[model samples]
Target: MKNFKTLLFITLMGSLCLTAQNNDTKRADKEFARFEYVDAAESYLKLVENGKGSDYVYGRLAESYYNIFNTVEAERWYAKALETSNDPEMIYKYSEMLKANGKYKESNEQMEKFASMRPSDNRATAYRKNPDYLPKILEQGKKFNVQNAGFNSEQSDFGGTLHDGKLYITSGRNDSRKTYGWNEEPFLDIYTLTENSDGGYDNPTLVNSYINTRFHEGLVSFAPDGNTMFFSRESYFEKDFEQDSLSRTRYGQLYLFKATKLKDDWDEVESLSINSENYSVKNPSVSSDGSTLYFASNMPGGYGQYDIYKATINDDGTIGEPQNLGQKVNTEGQEMFPFISSNNTLYFSSNGHLGLGGMDVFYTKEIDGKMAPIRNVGIPISSNADDFAFIIDEVSGEGFVSSNRDGGMGSDDIYTIKKLQPLCDVLIAATVLDDKTREPISGANVSLYDDQGNKVVTKSTNADGIAEFIIECEKDTELEVTMDDYESRKVALQGTSDEESPVQISLSPIEKIITPEEIVLNPIFFEYDKSNITAQAAFELDKLVQVMNKYPELVIKATSHTDYIGSDSYNQRLSQRRAKSTEQYVISKGIDESRISSEGKGESEPKIDCGTNCTDEERQMNRRSEFLIVSGGPESQE
Candidate 1:
């Protein structure tokens, strides 16, 4: 009996030790899943340090180290895993890591080994299509220490809005009622979190029963007062309730719900008048003043699949007509999730234009009643993932964006972004001059180049004959100035400083004349039976102003001629008047009148033989004015 008891004690101790070891491994796996890669790697390293380095443990350790960006440690464990096991998944991942680390020779060998082991697997063939596919952006994002907000776990939490020291995030977590039809995703509702004294967030609580329905709701925006809320909701009641429902409406629609603070609590949720049955609207954005509402919709007469529309808030708190923003603001592809910054600068997401793929954030400004060209906020804030639903604190440059890239809890995760100061201060200013006089030349192209010889910024000279580009210059920089028909001048500044000092550049005008081989002008109109200039003649004269503006050094002569339908003296007087009218109109349009000379050729310069009996059209064609390049101006021969 004593001998049997000693054996049982030994077996029981061994079983307890094995169970503890398995529990540790599972804890490490959970840590990795939570994106605590360094902690997971430390746990796996302990197992490796002990005499328990199995192939599975080694491979998992390598992945954890890779996530932590410890390439050296990752490579070491990957080699151990390859030596210990013939797992196809392990081999494939190891090969990819090797390729990413530029160990192509060994990477190719491992890939061949994986391919040979699984001949029927076509993943290797598909991967070869984009062999250089490195998720560089995602790899960098993993370094950011993002913490899960500890909201509902089983639902997707995204599209957070910070207002009045509280955070509101949308989630699809299940509700207690459970009466709502399940969407393809979990049921979504808005939950609010207040800020703690230590700059951390408190436990999230449901905002109100009025706003938290058991249906899909997300992408909420609040007015400046925080009393009015706009959110997206999808209703499938027509299809989900009916017995033979065939409704195909699966898209989200925008809804405005009013929440008034009454007795220290928000009460009475009601929809706004902007909600329409004709179109689906989502992603509402109100201007800082709260007078205009901008939202994304797929209504007719839009530029693309989805475009941003604006509706004015009437004095009586009603919405005006929905106006399409036109092609200038909208594109041929979907543009959504617009957010108006404090300065009224419009920021939105677009998938139509050139980008890193998925939706990229673009910003535009409404200046002088027209939307300026949309500018992409490049790099860092944007990536190849769907980086959208971003909101920035007006006072601070701190903002948050939602992305589904790797290193997140699951699905989409919210990331905090803080803008750093300008990298380099390159004071790029240009002084334009008259080439012949060596004076200032206005409206010339001044561009800045980086070390890679790519143009970074461009600006044209202002009316003061000075063009300035406040370039954020780094070490090695180049500046280039170009003008029409002129030799482009480039200056390389080595070791440029990031100081506030300015660098002035000079641009010489072009010496050569680039006249078109054939010149055609729209026929000038005249009063009936009269050859005098009219307001209609000002249209052709404006074209001459444009030509003079582009080619400042070219001189031209305006010759006016009349057909044989009138007397010689009358034709000469009319021709001279016409010539003076053209020259005077050019001067009025801001062109230097000295660059043009007028001549009256009367009936001598007719292109066709038009007698007194000719048709009105033929006579009108002969009674015309023409422009010819006479000579080079002061700067033309520079």
Candidate 2:
């Protein structure tokens, strides 16, 4: 999708719709139906200039430019076409143009209109479900910390490669060159940069003129030794391309060329033998050993418009036939800018797969002699605009990526990428012992909970009374410890450290009381609207578990309750699930299921009479799990 073709005579998806067939419009119809979009666009503009333009002519012109990805012109004509037309598809296309130009609010307006017209369409239904999705997309998770490269320009600068303290990039910074019809920008050229010790960059200078022509040239990749370089150039430089007979148009394809870095300058620039007159070959990404060359192509036998293809580098320097990366990497749409890391992971950009609207960067790693599922690199790296050419240093966790997102110095600017530590990485190490005797409590139950109150892991203390877990170092890591006739203990671990310290806990022994009254143990609390036992709750439950184990014939009943946030029926269902979960946990720890029964009290039995006006602390008391002795005490079951 980034190639930005001139669109002379393209391979059409199918025959285009035609409304006029007179001699004047006959030439335009043939060009339009064949998907000669640029030629079609030119002819339609001529008709408009001659005062013979109609709704069909204006619509065809918009569709032609849109197909060729000229959003600037497409937006102009789509606006004109929609003034009197009600075509739902055009509305969707208009929305796409508005989005590509960063007019998201206007885009959503058209999208909502289209969704109302075609309520059954999946794309429309999806847009209607979540029209304001940008904030959520941005907040998904941080994959990279990014900032503008110091050596960017007000033109399209992209395809960054770092080698030996120097940055090699491609850009349209040469204003002396002729403008490209696709984006109305200067043709691409290669540029290099060297950094100074003071963390500043020397101005980016041009590569050798022989390697860069007035035609498009960008995206350079080099060998590990920096002696050999493979890069993309326009096919017009080869002087062996074909032209369409009817249109008499010169079609240019992007091809890969090889050059060697010599003493003072690069020499012996030669086109790769795999160059074809019909298909494109660009975006070269070579291996560190120079044994494998990965590039993007629209050649035959590909699975998509532009698929990532690799050719083996032979010992004698000859190249093998290109191999498509297969359906796992290539889709029915475009895939380009492949980078094979030193660790053997393939990173590429894709638009066919599900993403956050435009091209999102995805990575695929090999496992067991096959490619694994492709994973989106996630937000802060990908956006609604085109994001590609991603590379990262796996060791230092710093690299670069190219994006056309808003607030850049150019249409496509290179952004420096850096990796930061995850939000959490705290390890939990806990120990349980008697408070007075200072003796280790063996086989004591311990549970770990994350900051979100999720039961992450559960383990029992060993002979040394230790339970350790490596978790995301978070704000509120809770640990629970309990033993027979001992007061339940709960401890919260919170700090940041590369090394974790053991959370030592001590429990006090409780006096044995023989009474006919049931002992109301402290409330085993849960997070809001949750049923699973937390680390704190687990500590309290373990006490009852130990007491029941001592008195083998003892029976207990657990009643769970919820606050006034939900409906009566729903809260009853939720509390029932909570009670069942608690009972199951006790049974799993060597207790008989028949000795434990559970019931849901819902919000009807709130001990805090504050009711609906209850504070969070008061609500916490309401959402409780209580245990009562039913039998095997001095008294019988009621």
Candidate 3:
């Protein structure tokens, strides 16, 4: 009887423990589904401690950490989840977490695995196309100067937008407000920073209590007239949510709201028609002319978890149907926080595009009524951590960017950004080669000159024949190369730095075809039956002029001949005109006219001597010119 009682008690306690774990798992899942990541993570950890760790629990834990931007915890849980989870998105998120933690090699391994699993995914396709994009991203020139804003608090603060001189941002620094389960920070509220006389911001204050609620509120956009504003807030403010019938869990989403400025405060708050209880619509951005409203939403048929959508603002104060920004702007990764500048450039944040890591900011501008391919806004504005909510003033060239990168005072800090320069620094790389052998030429001097003929810098070609220079882009520049026993060559830099291959420049040897009696030159071409100096004729004549200038006492006699098509008398006159034209060209190049003489041989000096049976090749060879050095060489004769 005592053994039986002990067994029954053990079984009852075991059943009760299992029941408790089941209840805890359900509670944690409810929190996670409601976006309460902080509480969900804690609950899931407790379940793991109680020996209830499954693949589902591990994935939920990993995702909870990821949503909170806790890279360390996220990476740990993702590794555990991947032991049994085959989901490609999980693998991608794992890779992102690894990158955030600076495990780039490990991150790449996970990315390759993810790409194999989901080859058609946009992110996967992008990876397969360029597996080694990190170097290019890191080598990109800096575009903005970033500095920590003084008003940042110890908690998360981001989503900065500037209007009229006042800076507005979403922050979680209210110690008096209720803390959110997403991060242990207080519920987010809209705060304003007034610009001071020194072009700096003053202390932050709540924008308006009526516009803010106990739930999250921020990410504001102002109309051009400053009389109205659109912002985001949790749907709970309007008592709109979906309740799970069994668990009574209320799931709320961020919704868009608009308010009108009344007297000193804002009022007349109302939700936009686009907000729905089934999906989120947040991060409102108004166009400069108030003709369009851009926002991020996870509504039905989106390319990613949240895609940026823009709707026309009807003149009657109603919004039109939202339209997707298309695949060029919306990838199969999260794209959010769309900010349209006065110049119609759309700036947003995304992880789908290739970048340094995490969510990098990107921008696109309309070209000929079509949106251009998006380009990453590159570092100092982006980093290994989550960087989003970028806004810029096109006129002032100053703006604010939000980042959770290292060295910030909080989880996500808003940094003031100033446009230092356009992304106009170009790396000009050239390879010098021998013209005769087509082999790399080492120890060659390569110099760069600006459009103003100012010498920028000089570098020597290495063993592989490479000389690199970084110069200001979009400006005309020249590259001049020289080497011993090689003719100096100068070429204008043609295309922009987008070309990856080094510019190959072949240099000819300085040894021309010269003999003791004459300076041999290539055939100088002329028009049919004409004596005008063609471009080819001038080029060959320059060689003769160069030889004459080298030895001041050198004299040259130019002789010209004609093919047998013309009569001898007519051929004589044509040949004489051609000879005189060559002589005049040398004189135009500053050669002494008296040193160079001319003579016409007509058809009498035909080297081929084919006569009427002459082939075209024989006739071409018959029409030629000669430059004889009458005086000035070791074997010269007077």
Candidate 4:
């Protein structure tokens, strides 16, 4: 009887041990299904350390590491899994992981082997074509380490809002009342989490049901005083309503909810009536002063399927008419999830413009009631997946966004992003000037040329008689300065350092004969019938040609004026012909064709003022030919 009793006890102990191992395996599987790879990995490692699992254990551990982006460990376990089992899933996942880590050659070999095993697999075919199937942007550091908010798995913890050392996220994980069908994966309810001294978040607790409900809710924005809150909520068919008005009005409707701080807790939850039935609004962004509200909606008369609109808040707490931000801000695609920073710069996500693949975050500044050009935040902040819904901590400069790209836990994951301050370098300045009078000449063109004579930047000076410019040049750069009558100047500088290092240039003035002492002639009346140059005019022009021939560097602006006698258009054409004739005569005498510019200011700039009707002397003054000393030697500069 003693021997039989000892045997029975040993049999029961063996059964209990087997049951415990099975239960452990089941727990790991459950964690994996919930996309909790870190926890699942811990469980799998425990099983491996205990040495009580099948080949599947090695493969599962490898997959968990790959999901968490531990490439070295993933490779080690994948090799171990291969030694135990030649499963196709394990092989494919291993090849993908190798490719993701830039081991393309080895990945190709594994892919070829997998293809041979499963010739009908289209995924294998894709891998064979492009073994390094990872996006270039992802390789440029788009992926980040994600921290799971330790809330109930059944809750939807998203649309996180940070204000005054607290984080408010939406989660439906605890809503026991099933009054509505889940629109999002598991639905959502609003919850708040406070920050601890160590910069970690405390466990999230549910806000009052006045804000959260059995229905879907998310996207909270707070006023500066923290007294008012704006959020989005949707009512579904399962909710009890007398007239089903919520179905028509509140379905996918974003409502504004407000609460007052009572002692240490927020109380007095009330719905704000600032919406209409014509459009569904989401993503509310209040201006820094809290006077204007910017949100995304799909209303009529918009540039795209969905656009961003702005409204003014009245003193009585009512919203003004929503104004479409015009085509400059709105695009022909979906634009949502707006965030207005303290600087009044608007940041939002859009799917309408060129991007990696999915929605990308873009920013534009509001300058004097006009929006500046929108600019992409570029790589690392954007990816080849839906990257949206971001918030920045004002003091820490740390932020987070959502992405579902290649290297995440599942379909979507929250990622933390920290701004990296750019490196600072030295400042440089370059200026161009006329060598003679030292007066800053307006419209003087300057070009910075390279060693190969290729132009870099063409710029003109400002009105301060100084054409000041800043450039970041490590070595010497050649510069070329030229104007209409001035000789082109070229200079080169070497070993110039410091921000305020002066690069003052002096261009020698080109010599010319169009000074005040040159030949002069006024208008010569033709007695109502004339088409030839008069004797006095010919003599004056002869002197002008002599002046032109003397100075090849001079450029004369010859203008012809006409009286308001003939048809205005006809007189204008005639004056233009006369001016061209003078220019042609100068060119015929061997003067450079490029040195002269002619124009007809017909019946304009009369020496004496007159009404519609004018005296003969006034008409004579209007019908004269004039030459201004536009640019030349000493007196022209004066």
Candidate 5:
């Protein structure tokens, strides 16, 4: 009877302990899901102390530390999680944490494992392509000379934007306000540092009392006229929130708000039409022209967790539909804090694209209304910890960026950025046009060649008839322009000083008469008594290649003729060589060999028919190659 009672007591205690653990797990999970990471970490730590460690628990614990930017704790828990968990994302995050802790080699080892597991992932592909990218990034040297902005507090302070002699920023130094569960910091508020007479910033002050609410608010963007403003704030300001299931823990999203300047202070504060209760819309940046509004959101139909989006700011001060920046500018990870410069370069922060780690600042210019290739802004602006909120001025070569990198005054601090180098080594903007019409010509190929005549770079003319190139400034180069049915033009690349002038190229259309039987191009001229193709001949032959490429099924016969200046046999041999050369050249330009046939007509099919008494001009016309469309003709796919 005593043994039975002891066994029953032991079993009951075990049940009670399991129930308590289960309750703790549920609470921690809920806190984590609601982004209450500080509380979640504490609750999860209790589980670890009670010997209830699991792969899932370890992963959650590591993520909680990572979200709060605690690299040491995150790395420890991640190492524990990786002992049993094979999740690729967890491994990737662990690698990032390792990097933050200065364990690059270990991070790379884990990244290699991650790449093998998920080769198709963008992060994995980027790692595979440039596994040793860190040294190269450091070797590229610093583009920006950085310094502490000097207004940092003991708490989180970031998102600096300079406008009209004032530096605007977000700060969590309001000790009186409620502390956020994510970081245990006071709610964010907008503050500005006014420029003093000595050209340095003065002490910080709240931009407006109403704009600084009890909930989070900051990251302000002003219109071009400075009369209007756009900023981010928690939806809680309008009593907006969502209750999550039975827990009923209220969740508030960041929403974009617009306000109008009423003389000394901003008034008429209202949320923008793009704001929604389902997701977040923050980090507003108005274009230089104020025609477009750029922002970041995690709204539905996005390519990733959060994506950079843009909307047309209509003249009536209403926003059009928000359009995602697409895969080139966005990824399957978070992209946020978009800032558009005066030169149309869009700078944003993302961890998704190839970077040093965490959220690195990247820039892409708008080319012909499309986003150009995204490029990392490089070291000093990026780090292993969260680095974001980049803003710049093209003219001044000065800017500011927010970072949580090592040796910072607080969790996030603002740093001043001075560009160390000029924009592009040498910038050339070339414009192609028609010689006869003098109108902008689109779809023209513009190529840059060095002094040695080696082709350097080539670009197709955009809709604006412009092809821009950034090349070495000191080297002498040549610009060559070519089009389908136009004469090729070459001009020497001239060096200019500070002032920029567009290089204009005019090309004459290839004069041709297309008949049902044969396509007659401008006379193909070779040096006198030679069968080799000349530059002029090559130029005219390009037109034939275009026509053949356009109509793949078209078959042409090349027949060469010569003047009556030489013996019959000699002229026949020369014509034969010329005809074969023409056929071979066309084939070399990606045309099918079976589609073209060649023959030598000698002087029998001369256009002039002047015989031995022909003048130089008439004889030149007689010496030509005729493209006779035998099977497929112009009417098929013209």
Candidate 6:
């Protein structure tokens, strides 16, 4: 997540400092040990071309490229190494590279391999919980409202650290410095700006000449004396570096420095004792008491490329031996830019741990002296790009995060972040009406239940047959309306946002019988000449089924008719098929077959008799079906 000059890294394992018997292979190992991955990659290729390659060489070569964030080269050698070795760490690293290159399906394969070997790993556990975490990150809402800082420059600017009401930041605004190869931008320098009375910022002024260098400098944290400050600086200042023998090139690592604030500037600069020529120790953060300093480093014996470390800052200005913050806060990827808040909560940015996309800001508070699970700050503060260097004023609930995402003036930019309140719940409402008369039914009991059948709210319909409810957004809600003699009805309610729509419920009257001689009802139409019963026909048949069930001693005869369009025999067969289908459908709904019979009227008994000169409407009327109760008629039931 931390990229460019700010990020630091080391080999996957300290034990990877392999010494080969051959001089050529030894040369490659030394280059990798010195962290010259580009040169080491070439040296390793020479050994493989010269027929002296092994899984150890390939794995270390892959790790060399990985440390440089060269995922393409990393994946190549990792694949080659897989032919010879099955190291779980190799699989994990390969999975990360594959995912970085957008090969998620293959990455999951590698992750499964790693999980089978090391099932207890936290990374494995996180992957098992969510093999698809990208969408969850994309779906997450913005964690903070962000805007541009008044003091942002027209070049790469980031790392906003607030100290004594003044904001110190890192920038590549100085064109005088050499262009850094990482982004073809000028090397970084420390800049300071004071807050204006109107919540604006004064024009930034570069820090005192002594505290900066021709290479790069990161953000800073000040001690209680305000004179003592600690920050990240490139080791080139003192020629503290390692040389690649094969290429005759020197690479400087990152180091932490302590400086004293003189009048209007910072001076008395001195590199910390923990600074190493073999590895990087950068990104400094200080406790409020100034007795402890937290930083990120790639020193040997750490859990990963960059691990958070803590050191005791003694009164003599020297620091105690740095201790790795432990695996709980470190992983196999970059974790840097730590800030210890006034309340002792440790906040940092990491890509090694599970998070949104790229580098996400995370916080962990001490619980009984142990750090809790690192919680992501989420989006708006984090993104799919580099998001680091988060510091805040807890009282104001305002902070700043550095990012190289879109809309930036340069490579990386600092944004003012403010926390906002969450949104409100959805409103659900319903209306009840009589089914037959289509009239509003007042004083009806309406109950709302969630998808789990838990009752949420209950109310009676008003004079307008409306029952309103305010509820939280859930998967589905059932709105039930019931009256004394009408059958109860329920309607489902659902939405994606805080929207309200009234559900219309119609309760039918529980009538047991209809006109027995000629039951007049809504027509149930069928598809052209088809014997299959339609849903509308089934609904009409349900009324008969309910009536028949109400009076068990009832017997009914169904008669079907058709227009005179086809041959008489064909017409007769079609009508008979319709009659049989209706009879079968009724019997399927629990009606006794022995108590029901059917007949085909064909074109003989037409409801609208116009001979062969019949209009389409007359023909439609002639094609119909009727049900008559022979035994338990309406008069008999009455």
For model 1, name the residue pairs that clash.
172-187, 254-281, 424-473, 426-473, 432-440, 432-441, 433-439, 433-440, 433-441
- List per-candidate RMSD values in Å: 30.4, 21.7, 28.3, 32.2, 22.3, 24.7
Tell me the whole-model lDDT of each prediction, alpha carbons only.
Answer: 0.66, 0.77, 0.82, 0.64, 0.82, 0.77
TM-score of candidate 1 against the unseen true structure:
0.47
**Candidate 2: residue 536 Cα off by (Å):** 28
Preferred candidate (lDDT higher): 3 or 6: 3
How many steric clashes does model 5 contain? 0
In model 6, pairs of residues that clash are none
Per residue, candidate 6 scores C-alpha lDDT tens digits across 180-250 of 77888899999888888888777788887798778899878888778888988899898888789999877
lDDT of 3 by residue, 1-638 (tens): 99999999988987876676567689998876655556688889998998888777898889877654566898999999899668888999899778756677798899999999899999899878767767656656477899998788899999777766778889999999988777789999999888898878878889777888899997999988898899999999899988999999879999999999888678999889998989999999999999999999999998988899999989877889999898888889999999999978799999998887899998876643456556777888879888999999888888899999999999999999998776444557789999989999999999877764545567799899998765545667888887766656678875464413258899886555468877778787887876756544654565666566666788889999888988999999888877876765676567776898888889989979998999999999999998887877634423
- Model 4 scores a TM of 0.47
Estimate the TM-score of every prediction. 0.47, 0.48, 0.50, 0.47, 0.60, 0.47
| lDDT: the better of candidates 3 and 4 | 3
Please report how far candidate 1 places residue 187 from its true position, in Å.
1.8
Instruction: List candidate 3 segments past 4 Å from native.
Output: 1-131, 424-638
User: For residue 343, what is the lDDT in candidate 6?
Assistant: 67
What's model 2's overall lDDT? Answer: 0.77
Q: Which ten residues in a row have the lowest lDDT in candidate 3?
A: 493-502
lDDT of 5 by residue, 222-305 (tens): 899998999999999888898789987889899999999887788999889988888999999999999999999999998899
| Model 6 poorest 10 in a row by lDDT | 6-15
Better of 2 and 4 by lDDT: 2
Estimate, for each residue in 233-327, the C-alpha lDDT of model 4 and write its tens digit.
65332232234555563444555455667776667765545554545677787777878888888877889988988888677666788888778
Better of 3 and 5 by TM-score: 5
